[model samples]
Target: MAGTGPQVARSPLELLNNQAAAEPPLLVKHAGPVIFSVVGFIAAAGANWATRRPLLSGVHRYVLIVGGSMAAGIYVEKKRAEHLATRDAMFRHYIELHPEDFPPYERKQFKDLFQEWIPIR
Candidate 1:
């Protein structure tokens, strides 16, 4: 919760903390092929006692390609979502506290500012 009452303002720290709580856990749980590929590459070099050349080489390529893409995609999506949510929250807070400060052009500017805050998906 940010704050109580209609006139109360949410502090920046409070907003951030509330946002953090509302957001999903930061970890990328399923790393796809990336994990297996890196491990396989290391193993292929015979660094581990259990290393097997054929298995390592066979899996390495697929894991590197598929898993790396999946992981990168997930990361980008999470970042974009966080940015948009923060922008939306800030915009709402501004409008609530300063309803009379905006002209039509300033409203457009706010919309533009919100869009600018997030990277294009």
Candidate 2:
């Protein structure tokens, strides 16, 4: 006997698979390695010069030391700013709810409870 029910439609997953199969490969697949190779060469050259011995023996050493320290200091400052922003956002929410100081013990308790629900690393 012929089928009694209506024909079922294709699900979204099937339609998506068909669409994906029709498209060309990603641009990055063809261009990524070429870009990476060029960048790697540039980075290697820069590192080599930054580390190489100088006409004056101590000059190269001093430059490398100062440059590295400055880079590290900038990176640390950026990270500290990001961390403070995150901490402030977390505390701002609490201050909005309670104007008075939240005790250290209570703050810890709240932090632990909140983190347990939605952990942040």
Candidate achieving the largest TM-score: 1
Question: Distance (Å) between predicted and true CA of 47, model 2?
Answer: 21
So what's the TM-score on candidate 1? Answer: 0.36
Model 2 C-alpha lDDT per residue in residues 32-58, reported as the tens digit of each score:
444444454455456656889333455
Q: What are the clashing pairs of model 1?
A: none
RMSD list, candidates in order:
14.3, 21.9
lDDT of 1 by residue, 5-80 (tens): 3332234334433434443444544443345445545544453335534543555555565566666666766777
Name the regions of candidate 1 deviating beyond 4 angstroms.
1-59, 102-121
TM-score of each: 0.36, 0.34
Compared with the true structure, all predictions reach lDDT values of 0.53, 0.51
lDDT of 1: 0.53
